[model samples]
Target chain A: MSEPIVVIRGVEKWFGGLRALGPVDVDLKPGERLGLIGPNGSGKTTLINCLSGLFVPDKGTIVYDGRDITREPAFRRARMGIARSFQIPRPFTGMTVLENLLVPMDYLGSHERSELERADEVLASVGLAARRDAPAESLSQLELRKLELARALVTEPKVLVADEAMAGLSENEIDDVLALLMRLNDTGVAIIMIEHIMHAVMRFSQRMICLETGRIIAMGTPQDVAQDRQVQKVYFGERAGA
Target chain B: MRTLPFLVIAALILVGGLFLPQFVGNPYYFFAGYVVLQYVVIATGWNILGGYAGYINFGTSAFFGAGVYVAAFLIKAFGAPLPVQILAAGVVGMLLGVATGYLTLRIQGVYFSIATVALVVVLETLIHNIDYLGGASGMQTIAPPAPAWFGGQTQYVFCAMLVLAVVAVVAARFIERSWIGRSLRAIKASEPAAEACGVPTLSMKLVACAISGAIIAIAGAPYAYYASHVDPLSAFSLTIGLNALAMPLIGGTRSWIGPVIGALLLASVQQIATVTISSEFNILAVGIVLIAFVVLAPEGILGLIADLKEKLRRRGARP
Candidate 1:
């Protein structure tokens, strides 16, 4: 592959005395679809948090587009085109859906286009055009997830770290979101998807990384990582110790 | 409303208000109007941070007291005029705001509020010890001669306050309708989400704190001249902080008009209560009205009005 868009080296995070994540390394190429899968408490969110500039790594450096961004604040990182969706929907309260999109557009978007048109386009792309004027608090589960994705997409980010964007979504809703992500990937934006759903991620990702207790247990193509002994053991509990 | 038309209307109304002392023979009206207008400025300033950004500032007295002292010092040392004192107070209050925000904003919620309260106590004690600013005792300040057209010091000061109120309201309104206002709302709603959207939450909060402090201190700058005395007990009065918070809540915290309405309604009630009944009833009135509004109309009069309008519209549509 050509020069990677993001290079993370030896990133580690500690909460008090407990080590939450890493000594992990990851490289994401331009327009790449990377799947990050792990069970609960496996530090998937923690790793993404570090990558998105929420937590400064206790050790290691992150270089984004060849600039050292390990110590950058979250907003600066976002302005630098790295955007993330929260695991939980965090729609700005007391605002309309269109106003919600206007916020990021106001702060980080290109001023070449009218902000309303850009916001409306993103809303339509996510199938939320009908609900554009609706209050964020009034959205349903699927709509909230779509809003989360739409918000991330509104930034027109180079790297979109979607943390459980498909959780609590219906099966049909899952395919809809999956198609949205695929379409976005086709537009030359790299995506790091953190999901608990196996088949959906396996289908979306060209490469996969399985994390267990903050360390990578497997990294390969979908079929290869799925059948890996270590990944299978982590998923199925080693078949009762053989 | 568009910026130009809103400004034009506000200017006309404020200029008309400046002529009020000419019509009313009673000097008490100007005296009372000064206090109400001062509250308008304070409540407007308070809402910029408290209502919009959701940062409760118990240090209203701290900034106000600082302005009172700053103006007193200028008056005593340089015999500076009201405008100069106000300008100086704004600068000092802004610095204090930046310092306080830097120190306390890292701690969220009630912890931040407690720190602001602590700031009040700390500043109060520091002011009490400073002999130059009259220490535990108070200093009397004499006002410069009022202009001929204004008639008296009270009327002139009332005009000055009316101007400041307009400025404060316009500033608050501008912030509400601007990008900064949207960013502050985002910070209030969710800091992490705002930051992820490239809002720079900490810096935006500091901006709110600075502007809020400067405007509040501007309200206080003329107080020494108005009251004719600056003392720790009165300058750092508990009532100022209470009313600063209560006025915004009673008006509506969501928009610029809310605080203005709140200040006008609450301050007028207190003034009338002081006139008709015992002066002690001022706080009592505030307490009763505040509790009623909190219970029955938690969103304040503006919210109530909006709900009423919505219901009326729905009814009309049904017909």
Candidate 2:
């Protein structure tokens, strides 16, 4: 189609000579549901971190919306409409769920409708209107994930990278999140779902990629990647070889 | 909304200062009262960074000491007016705050606190060794200005600043009620989440530091003039740091007015204890209160009021 919305070429990150992830390249298009699946320490998170500007890549350039954001700070990337959810949901403890949505809205600095109204609508859209005033620490795990998504969505981001949003979630909860993300995809927001859960990810993602030891071993349709020799060996090795 | 008692108490202290000779008639209490106000300023400032942002800074005395040395130098050399001296001190403190924010904000855990403590030691050693800014001998023979207005009177200056403090409290209260205040509270609660949601955590923290440093420094100028002189030891000493932390903890870090209340009440009690019991016991006494309150009343006296209100509400609803 047209140029990809996100292009990562020759990206590499190392922690003290340990290449946690890279020399990797990937492209994400507008309104695409991309599933990034990897075993533990497969560099999925690292790649996401580099893309979100959490850590500067040791090498390679990350182009988003036709500009190189390789050296941008996390906040600047957010301002440019790039957002991500943490692997561990970090709802601000002691703040209401509604307030969690409102904090990021302040970054917009007097844009669009009233700030409070904007926060309220975001909360409602996430199915957290009833729990808006509740302390974040008190939220159920699923609710926390929803609040996390609402926060990323509040920036009106073009790309929302959800890191392990389905981790530790029940099967039904996983389905719930899948549906929620699908709804957003329908609204033209590209979502990069980094997950370990196979069935849910397979059902949700239009395309799936498998990462092993910081390198992409497989990238194709769910069935293709799942049936790939290396992917099957890695999962089989974990069960019997380990 | 929770700051009413504090506003009233601060007013009462000012009124009490008016008729000091008729009541306790002790200059020592006035001295202590002045110290309390100064501590309120420090505690409030430290609370912005330490209490609100959860960045514990042990180098408050460094900024306070900067205000002390600069104010003393201006008065000693050029004979600057109190207002001018105070204004200069505030600007210096704000600048120092910016520098500290830049240097230490990136650090997490004990490293941040250590950086601040190290800053204090660095500044203190510089003052102790250097000949200018009073060195070891310290500035002496300072004459506390009576100010020309109100006919060279303490009452006039006191009234004006007391009015100013009231205005400051009001503005602080208004901020507490508004959007910026809520954002600070959010950032304080969880910085990463706040940032992800679009709160500018770094800038919010820097602004807190700037506002905090400026106010604490402004509070110092009057005290520097009141004491008539300041040495490196008295100005940069851990006493101000201890008092600052203590007042906020004792009053409860929950509300904006908490530190102010803690400063006045705790300062008054210590003054009376020093006179009636013994001078040496004063330090021991406040230290005890600091430890005891944090351990026993972690919520502070204000939190107690909230509990009492809840109990009363429950009782009224009983069948």
Model 2 lDDT per residue over B1-319, tens place? 4567766876786676555534453445445555555666677777766666767778888888887777777877788877777789889999988888878887765797889888889988898887767687676626445644333334433443454355445555655555666667766776665665666778878877787777667666665567666778878878777777788788877567877788778877877877789867867878998889878888787877777998999999999
Return the top candidate by TM-score: 1
lDDT value for model 2:
0.78
Instruction: Name the regions of candidate 2 deviating beyond 4 angstroms.
Output: A111-113, A236-242, B2-29, B148-164, B174-180, B304-319
TM-score of chain A of each: 0.96, 0.95
TM-score of 1: 0.96
Native-to-model Cα distance after best TM-score fit, residue A2 in candidate 2, in Å: 2.8
Largest lDDT belongs to which candidate?
A: 1
Q: Candidates' TM-scores?
A: 0.96, 0.91
What are the per-residue Cα lDDT tens digits for candidate 1 across B3-80?
A: 899999999979798888788778888999999999999999999999999999988999998888999989889889
- Model 1: runs farther than 4 Å from truth? A109-113, A238-242
> TM-score, B chain, candidate 2?
0.86
Global lDDT of each candidate: 0.91, 0.78
Q: Tens-digit lDDT track for model 2 on A41-107?
A: 8899899989988789999999999999999877788889889999998877756787677667766
